[model samples]
Target chain A: MIHSDLIRRLPASMKLAAALAVVLLVTAACGGGSSSGGGDTAGAAGLEGKTVNFVGYGKDNPWGAYFNGVFVPKLESQGVKVVDLTTMDPGTAVTNFNQAISNKPDLIVAALLDTSSTVVPIKKAKQAGIPVLVFDGRPDPSVDADVMQVLSDSEALGTAAAQNLVEGLKAQGRNSGNLIAITGTKSGFAAQDRMKGFDAELAKTPEYKVVDIQDGNWDPTLSGKIATQLFAKYGCSGIQGAYGMADYQALPIVAAAKQAGCPVGGKTGLVVTGSNCFKVGIDAIKAGTLYGTATEDPGTIAEQTADYVIRYFNQQNPPAKELVKEERVTAENVAQFAEQCSKA
Target chain B: MNVMSAPPRSDAPIRRPGRSRSRAELVIDAVLLLAVLAAIVLALTTHRFATVANAKAILTSASLVGIAALGLTLITIGGSAVSLAISPSVAAVGMIFLSAQSFGLVPALALAVLCGILITGVQGAIVGYAAANPVVLTIAASFAITGIATGVSGGSTVSPTGGGYDRLNATPGGVALSVYVLIGLALIVQWTLRRTGFGRSLYLIGENRRAARAAGLPVGRTTAVAWLAAGALFAVTAAFTAAFNTSANVNLGGTLTFDAIAAVLAGGTPIAGGRGSALRTLAGAVLIAAASDILLLRGSSTGVQILVKGVIVLVVVVLVHLRTEGSRA
Candidate 1:
């Protein structure tokens, strides 16, 4: 009986050791953080002739123009050729990416507005022996291992906006009042996260009363419409400030408030702030229309994505993920960033 | 006259529960009433739901949607509930107005209406003459129009950089103006349906097509005219939407189709044909807006809101179907 017990324990101990060794090896591999593929560039240095194609949304918007015009130039200065197959229509653009992958480019970079729509294309790209790098959008968990993604701590964008609003209120010496939040399309991930972030931060302060939240569908007209009525109903009383999801949204809120003859800009105006660094929002900040706005640097994201594609091409160890930082652009620094953006 | 008799029935059930809905034969009326109730309830219960601000917002958002619903009402009552690609047609036409806003607001708006009328008339003529399936025909027309809009705008939103266009959209009483436009459209459509002989012919053809054919009704001409009217209405709505949004994109009228269709169905327009009123559709549109607004105020997610709407639409459609069949049986 003793001999049999020893035999059973020996096999169990060996199995446990083997599992522990596998986990330890993975931990070591992941913990060792040199994205240069552990200096494996000896053979990859000759990858100068490779081409990486990129497809994204908002192809004709100002964001796209900067990415294509300025960021592409930055990457090309490093000897990487970038091909664009981009469009604004979510469905159509995803299809374009699917077709682009069939040709098997060296690498592909895509920014899917909605993660759900891009799954098929991303999966197909990965399966077809092409490495796909996604930026500015979340990825589905099932498909996460297939492609690498770059994201921002957007929740922080929300908290920062809320903090700015709180400070503005404090500057006005507000102990109690209503604050309305105007959100982008209610279903969008960014809209929900940003709203939650702002809401969570605002909750920390007891005196500020959050009255209502409405979805503006990220349309200026809709935001203006919502703001117009909110101003007329509440006037400059009760409501101390407002939070908008994006600059596009902030423009309308400002317009509606201005139309209603409500005090705006500076400390006296409705304290408005948002995420997404559109030129209009930065201008709004400088003009004292918006209190604060978050900047993601789309051009930087584009440039970084370009760099990532280059890394994959060079067979350098790719980082599992990358997170870009967003800074709150207020009246203090709106001019500086605005100048750079305008130049782009 | 005796020879033009109702078709013989083959042992159909005389009546069914939830059938014979004469009280709500007009779906639009019920939809309208429901919408009004929803708005009142939403505004009352939800914080800041019924505030003047929300009302203004609702009206502003509803302006173009309300106008588009009016056009759809005309088409539905014209004996065929079809748009002939009215949505995208108007969106494309409105771009021209937006592009030419430097001239003046009145002229820009007028040109947009004209463009819309022409596009719809052409479509009406083709669909009328071909006698094609409205679904397939309108789908093709939509695709073509969307392509054109994309080509014209280069798949981007084109804002009125500066001009009367901005002034018109930003006019302080923009909401009121939109409401007045909707009222005027309703009155005009009501007058056409009730006062004109062509209107009676429309109902006649819708109720009994073969009988109307025997009575020598100009069915094709009526459909063409109705479609043209819809096109014109859609054009105005598109212009308003573009002006209000301060931009025009390829998906300008994308959301209107579902809204318009929902309003029409909820208002009690029988899909089988020939029984609805402008009043009913107006109410339906309001109700749809009110429902969405209520959900929005409740802080519901977009997905949940859409799901609720889908369920409501499904239930209403089933009821409408049952009522239609029960009335006949």
Candidate 2:
């Protein structure tokens, strides 16, 4: 009551001054704290007052959420001005890229969903004198428009999923059997790369044959339906393992398999694995309904991408290509990664 | 020359214009029968395709699309054409359901369905009362709903924290709860359309809007009711979908709008409206589901399956159109 009365007695200008001082103090404290934290490059030279155009998926997409929620804020905290040109539609994303290039910000950060359509806009951005930092997608190798590309290593995710599935199968006392792969959109770069890696890794253990590779389009319903049909076609005993490209897809596959009387996971039944470390996969691992999942975590990818951006601005000479490290999470290690996966 | 001249009249009961089985209806029936026959033949030939497990799979897969189609059927019947907003509405409701799950199952579901009704119902009002173009209005609504849902969710998946709703995903006696729900809803919707005054008004308005207006029928009210009912069905679809997946996201109802529209057209419902049955839509949904499953089981690619579905829809549409046109002539 006394403090309120004293403030009421003060003039409006004095109150305004006090508020400004408090804000400055808070800002300084945050800046000091952030510089010593994970965002060590906060307020780094060259980044302050710089402008960056971020063209990627809309905030509704999980990866887009990470970019907007984590990457943009991290960069902004360092005094970088970010212009959001994100979109949910692939077509709109292309348009946004062109718009961003026209704007000619000091730097451009893009994560195009359709890699095939990105090369031209990337070149256009380069011609506009904008240094592009790409993430989440890998454009053609010949397209050297980007200063650096930070990717989740989709192939490694696939490889890890394959390894986990194999390990699960072996643990179930099976050396060789039929496996099925339910992939995302067939034309997507990530899906194609993941499949390539998966196939390559599975080749080492030729005894386990991939009976089918169906496109689930990263849709849970479609994936579940595909699983149901595959299980029926192969029966409960014919197929011993499966791979769903995402945890959402993987969870449905488990349900469909169970419905088909071919329960997955544990020491028996079909072994299932997925990528994209989502909370669903972690929970499934905990419940022993899913064998494992590989880390294609959006949160980690976003953080690493933000770090690369800071480095690029600091002239630290980041490599042309940076692959975010990924790991497999099974029942043995799911607990360790559950919190991170859940956050994603 | 003598246009006003009156002739001697005989007392005979004047018959009202009523729905009679048309050539288009016949074509739809024939197509459905052929599809069933083809399914049976494939089942006989392919050991894997004939299993009880595959049947359950087909029905379970069809359930969500079937439910959504039932709602779209009402809109189509009420002469509003199709709502491009169905998928977004479904996604929004699913998100709402998951978001409200902390309130417990019944309330969450009720709230979710209510949200669906409000979303589509408002659009319906615009289209009905304001005489807005449904296609354009629904397209705009789709964008708005998607934007709102995305903003609210921040593009994150909404996972359910509670139980009980998982019962909707259960398969009792090898039949999914979703499948049963679809059947039950189908029966109710069919009865409603056939036996209710609102249903008759929809047919009347859809059949001839000018004539219905001239006859003092409640055209706007019927259209709104159709949309409201459809919204409820869509909510049910979202609920079952979220329950089955154990999660929901802004992408919850991927390809649903197109699929439901396709199902409605495939069911032999005239795009011009006024003529169709929920049972026909059910048959169409089942046929499409079975065909897709058969294609998948045969190792066909997604492209091939989509191509096949396109062919089926096109063939049905062309046949029905031709038959309807011929009958009109």
lDDT of each model, Cα atoms only?
0.68, 0.82
Candidate 1 at residue B4, lDDT? 24
lDDT of 1 by residue, A153-218 (tens): 678788888887887888777776688888877777777778778889989996887887877787
Error of 1 at A278 (Å): 3.8
- lDDT (10s digit) by residue, model 2, range B1-329: 22112221111112236846566657766886896698678757765788777888888888889999999999988788899998889999997887787788899989988988999899888877777899999999988998898888878888887776676677788777789899999999988887777777787777777877788877887888899999999999999888767778878888899999888888888788878879889988987888888888877898898898888888878877766664554
DockQ of each: 0.14, 0.38
lDDT of 2: 0.82
- Considering summed lDDT, which 10 consecutive residues are worst modelled in model 1 chain B? B3-12
DockQ, 0 to 1 scale, candidate 1: 0.14
Q: What is candidate 2's lDDT per residue for A93-147, written digit by digit as tens?
A: 8999877766656677888778778888877655555678888868876685454
Worst ten in a row by lDDT for model 1 chain A: A34-43
**Which residue runs of candidate 2 sit more than 4 Å off their true CA positions?**
A1-45, A144-147, B1-47
Clashes of each: 12, 1
